[model samples]
Target: MTVYALETSGLTKQFAGFTAVSDVGLRVRRHTIHGLIGPNGAGKSTCFNLLTKFLAPTRGTILYEGADISRAGPAEVARMGLARSFQISAVFPHLTALENVRAALQRRRGESFDFWRSDRILKRYDADARALMAEVGLTGWEETLAGEMPYGRKRALELATTLALAPKMLLLDEPLAGLGQEDVGRIAALIKRAAEGRTVLMVEHNLNVVASLCDVITVLTRGKILAEGDYAAVSANPAVQQAYLGEMAEPAHV
Candidate 1:
């Protein structure tokens, strides 16, 4: 088998004659956490969309587990054990945290979401759903409505639902965005735990979390790779430094 969990070659995306991602290649090793960081408008999100099949690439190839997935749809890729979380917390607002996770568990079992089904039919997923909730530190919030939960808790719940799919690879888009300092630390730790036995690809603006959690970091600027290495090596590169232009504050040690 392949050493890489995901790979892209000559990946390019253009919007109305403007190239957003140009001639990019990315490789993520198996069972490792890889971080993608760049300044605003660097096409990080666009690249992510292409990888997840939310947007079609203008030209390129994407391989997941050595199989060509460039032509696959989002749901197809997801069912193949590649799951993604959004920049915004995506939870069913009216559903309790446990129910939200149960919904995902149902999907994983290839069952249609029969909201009208009796509680007895749905109870089969409860144990697994609660386990996932506990995995993300939402044990006590199981009965709480997802929308009523605090922002940090909502993010945690989202992670729980994502985990219910039992994915082999996770694509997290800005997992630390809009978080307070305390919540940032908590969520970062959760992400670390989630990476166990799974490959993770994350796009985050939080430099400290990236430095501590990522096994490899790829720096992009103006939609192209500027440098790729460990945090120390990438941080020391003059080109990467110039690209950030002081936005790359010295990350605090975790």
Candidate 2:
């Protein structure tokens, strides 16, 4: 078995004549949380789209669990146990928290979304859906409409839905993007709990969370890797320092 759950090599993406991501290689170890961080316009989102197959790479390959998935479509890769969450919370606005998660469970079973199915049939997924909700700290909010829930809770619900897929690797885009300070710790904790027995690749701007949570951090700048290492090593790199010079002198632990 390979040590990496996800790997990419010589990955490049070009828009018209401009390069968005160039010669990037990323390897995410099995069962570890890897952080991807960089300045705005650093190609983090583009790289993520390539990995998830939302956009085909102009060059190079993507491997998931040692299988080449470079040419696979998003749904195909998703069925292969690779799932991703968007920066924006994606949940059925009218669906209750439990229902949203149940829907995902049904999808994972290769069943068409049968929201109108008889309760007797849909009830089978209820227990598992509630458990997943509880896993993300949404136990008491089961009956609330996803859109009515607080932003942080909605993010958690999105996570529960992603977990319903039972992915081997998870790609989280800015999981903490819109969260307030208080909610940051809560969501970050949920992410930590979710990482158990799974590999996570996250693109985030909050360096403190990355400092605490990531086993390895890959820094990108101007469409290429600027530095990569544990928080201490990557934060100390002169190149990384210069890259974030005006924005942040250095990433500080809080």
Q: What is the overall TM-score of model 2 with all chains considered together?
A: 0.98
Mind giving the per-residue lDDT tens digits that candidate 1 earns over 1-254?
99999999999999999999998999999999999999999999999999999999999999999999999999999999999999999999999999999999999999999988999999989999988988999888989999999999999999999999999999999999998888998999999999999999999998989999999999988889889999989888888878888656464476
Q: For residues 1-254, could you state the per-residue lDDT of candidate 2 as single tens digits?
A: 99999999999999999999999999999999999999988999999999989999999999999999999999999999999999999999998999999999999999999999899999999999989988999899999999999999999999999999999889999999999898999999999999999999999999899999999999999899999999989888888888988444666766
Q: RMSD in angstroms, all models?
A: 0.9, 0.9
Candidate 1 stretches greater than 4 Å from native: 249-251
Q: Look at candidate 1 and give me any clashing residue pairs.
A: none
lDDT for residue 75 in candidate 2, whole number 0-100: 97
